[model samples]
Target: MSNYDITLPLTREVAAQLRAGDSVRLTGTLYSARDAAHKRLNELLDAGLPLPIPIENATIYYAGPTPAPEGYAVGAIGPTTSGRMDAYAPRLIALGLCGMIGKGERDALVVRAIRKHGAVYFGAIGGAGALLAEHVEDADIVAFPELGAEALRRLTVRDFPAVVVIDSTGMSLYESGRAEYLKSLK
Candidate 1:
């Protein structure tokens, strides 16, 4: 595995170079969206309506942060379980979503879509919300204000840490790492 410092709005060229298990510190803009936001985006897509946020070359972080403390930009911002967003990922991937930041494993279909679309899935440290929030320089709700924390938010991050869980080539660190560990035990 290699370590990299990457900026967001990831392009295919940059994404294609990442491999499962690589460590990355991402800087730049990231969009927040969980299940509710994804559902709404899907609905908009079905209706042939313009999406609330631009999809092309976008990186969506699966998180619903708590209200910020008095002086902070954000609060306890951590990744939600990625599986909850699996159902909606492929459609978004097809629409040019280049990256995702979250925890847990994604389903096979999502993996395939990631590969087919030249995208990468990065896994954040799940319980490190407080630490993660420090990386967020700013946060603003871009859409769906009534959804509260589940609202779509644009976040500006600097040196946000994550690991490549799945790569553009369809490689999965979860599967590979598990197999390796099991083999070592035997």
Candidate 2:
């Protein structure tokens, strides 16, 4: 496993270098954004209004985490399903967003966009909320704080475990894994 402290807006070369099933520990700032937030973000972008947060070269985690208790930055933060963000992802990536972290698989369209935009997608443990929360050392709302859990939070994380789901070369582990398994039965 390699440790990466990469900032978002990753280049094609960077995306191509990542492979499915590769273990990586990411450290740096991450932002939490979910469906509602994505919709609002798109609206803001489309209207020529400044985005609440600068997404360029930034990594976003799709989640609606539990509220934090006093003195804690967050509570039981975990990745939500990646599919819900499909509509907004390509637009965000085109705006220079570098990576996405979520649970479950992304659709083919998202994979293509990631490859085209020099971005990567990572999968984190879906239901492991407690364990995931421990990794978020600091967090603050950079956008839409009124949305509560659905608000966008800027977080500083350490040793966040994830696997590359899609790489810059358009390689997808989820598809490959399924194909390999199906072929074995033939």
Candidate 3:
């Protein structure tokens, strides 16, 4: 229920301080990667190959942004369904990925990994891509450019809005909020 203004490359301390249902305006650096990029990263991990981006204390956004128009930092950078990345998320979290930004429910395995690793999962507004793009100060494709929109990109965001849907302790706002609403109806 509290609000936070946090910067990225989230440390264990920062991750632990967050709680489910908290509002956040995240600033600083984060990476964009959809399911394809996540799969590639997992393959690299499995093969003992170097990853395209640093894994430690990193925050990955589940977004495949559109091509920016003239003078824009990004275009329609809305969150993709986080479940698409669920298969690969635990491995990344084990490698020190401390935060994620997307929409919808996460799988049980992903939630467990977040709790075990002192990480947090944030939810972005799904249909507010144009509004979200305004907060992105910079964006550059960093790897897998061949994948176009699915390519890994580095984004610098300022006051990017999100809500903490799952906190480090494994509290899930989605579950709790839904239960509360259902209870209210009864």
Candidate 4:
């Protein structure tokens, strides 16, 4: 797999060049949100209200971190299941949301949206929250602080490791890798 060091506030040109199964070390500011925050964001969207954070050319990490330990910027900030955000992802992608960081596979509609918008989906390893937190240089609540861990936070990450789970072209490593494994056994 190819390894890429990408600096974010991601652009469509950058997103389009990435491919599924490629390893990436993403460094830059990204927003964080979970189910509760996503629900609220959708509510704002439905009302035609302004979103709390900028959606254009931005990557959102699907996570809700635990309380930070003494002297640490954040606690175990791990990826939430991506499927939980499926209902809202397509609309956001169409609005210029460029990338997503999460665990698990996305539905077909979300994949189609990513392809159409030239967006991407990155996978953060599950159960490695503590390790991942080490890459978080800084974080602060950008909105919805009342939701506590589920608050939408602005996170500045440095060399955060991830895999291209689904690329802008709609290619999915989950499907391709599984297919390759099955073919090998035949």
Model 1 stretches with alpha carbons more than 4 Å out: none
Instruction: Residues 91-112, candidate 4: write the lDDT tens digits.
Output: 9999989999999989999999
Query: How well is each residue in 1-186 modelled by candidate 1, as lDDT tens digits?
Result: 999999888999999999999999999998999999999999999999999888999999999999999989889999999999999999999999999999998999998999899999999999999999999999999999999999999999999999999999999999998998899998
Per-model tally of clashing residue pairs: 0, 4, 0, 0
How close is each model in CA RMSD to the real structure?
1.0, 2.3, 1.0, 0.9
Give residue 26's lDDT in candidate 4 (0 to 100): 96
> By descending lDDT, how would the candidates be arranged?
1, 4, 3, 2
Q: Provide the TM-score for each candidate, comma-separated.
A: 0.97, 0.89, 0.97, 0.97
Candidate 3's residue-wise lDDT over 37-117, tens digit each? Answer: 988888888899999888899999999988899999889999999998999999999988999999999999999999899
lDDT (tens digit, per residue) of candidate 2 on 1-47: 34454444444566567877677777778899999999999999899
The Cα error of candidate 3 at residue 72, in Å, is: 0.7
lDDT of 3: 0.94
Overall local distance difference test of candidate 4: 0.94
| Candidate 4 global TM-score | 0.97
lDDT of 4 at 22: 95
lDDT of 1 at 106: 91
Question: Number of clashes in model 3?
Answer: 0
How much lDDT does each candidate structure score?
Answer: 0.95, 0.83, 0.94, 0.94
